[model samples]
Target: MNYNKLVKQKRVIIERCFGQMKCRFHILQYVCRIKLENVPKIIIACIVLHNVAKSLGDPDFELVEQDPDEDEGNHENDELPLRQLGQQINKKKLEYYNK
Candidate 1:
């Protein structure tokens, strides 16, 4: 089994899960402005709420659609550099895997 392939697939699944979670629970999108010491508690509360809502099969409370034309140019402009970097990183990982 290819470890790199397994890792990449796992990363994609994790991202999709987080995306669904955020879309379903818009309240979790914002950071709580509590004291530093209470930050962990705030995070735990948000996670508990998210899980309860998910278990209840609730629809997304907030879903915003992006304008198709707004970032049309930005996508092409940014993608090339990112693709190159990703390729480089993957190549290095492949080398490590082969070693």
Candidate 2:
């Protein structure tokens, strides 16, 4: 199997983990205003709690979408640069992994 293909396939697991985390912890779905240094700690705490819930055989709930009308903020303008950077990083990773 091509390394890229294998990596892409494995990516779904982490993506699903993120999805599940967002579903379990709605805070993950929205922008959190806090000190920059605490962001990782918050996310790590969520991950730890999520794992604990899973380990305890908690029921998995599907993500429920909030009303579209309630979302008034346009985030595309904010995400464009971040998305571009992510693409650049992904390309670099692919280059390194394919070598």
Candidate 3:
């Protein structure tokens, strides 16, 4: 198979997987309140749940794709300012408390 065609096929499979993941585990779409350190574990768990649901023949999957130009509002903020490390630490602390 052509490399480009293989890549496109993989992308489609990944999109379908994510669609099944989100519908089978609604929590995947929510803003996670857990610490950043735990995010990977949560995501892995969701993937496992998605695969199990798929294997068991659960349906109701929908794919979501973001528009390419939807990030214009954050263009200026893309590069964090040098001084924001302290600000990020403070924000994380606040999020910790809020959760």
Candidate 4:
């Protein structure tokens, strides 16, 4: 029932949804070539299609496993940038909760 725990749980669900979407809608796995303003509409359409397919009992395509070495580079180099971004987000979340 902790707020942090609830946020983590919701994040897991969201990540799972994205993973499934990427598998079923291969376009999602690639860089979107459309205008940034149109991105949300595209994502919404994909969600609708995904849900409809689920309702119809369509099976999800299995996610193709990529070599981690090919996609994910050295995490050590990313740590500083990620930490800075995470700090900003954490600050905003804390402010929202403190309100």
**How well is each residue in 1-99 modelled by candidate 4, as lDDT tens digits?**
999999999999888888999887888899978899998998899999888666545556555778877966577978898788667656655665587
The regions of model 3 sitting more than 4 angstroms off are 63-99
Better of 1 and 4 by TM-score: 4
What overall lDDT goes with each candidate model?
A: 0.66, 0.80, 0.71, 0.79
Flag clash pairs in model 3.
none
Task: Give model 4's TM-score versus the native structure.
Answer: 0.57
Which segments of candidate 4 are over 4 A away from where they belong?
62-99
**What is candidate 2's lDDT per residue for 1-99, written digit by digit as tens?**
999999999999889899999988888899988888998998999998787666545556566788978968887698888788667656655665587
Backbone clash numbers for all candidates listed: 0, 0, 0, 0
lDDT of 2 at 75: 75
Who wins the lDDT comparison?
2
Report the C-alpha lDDT of model 1 over 46-76, residue by residue, as the tens digit: 6676665555443434446889788455466
Ranking by lDDT: 2, 4, 3, 1
* Distance from true location, Cα of 95 in model 4, Å: 50
Tell me which of candidates 1 and 4 scores higher on lDDT. 4
Give residue 80's error in model 4 in angstroms: 51
Pairs of residues clashing in candidate 2: none
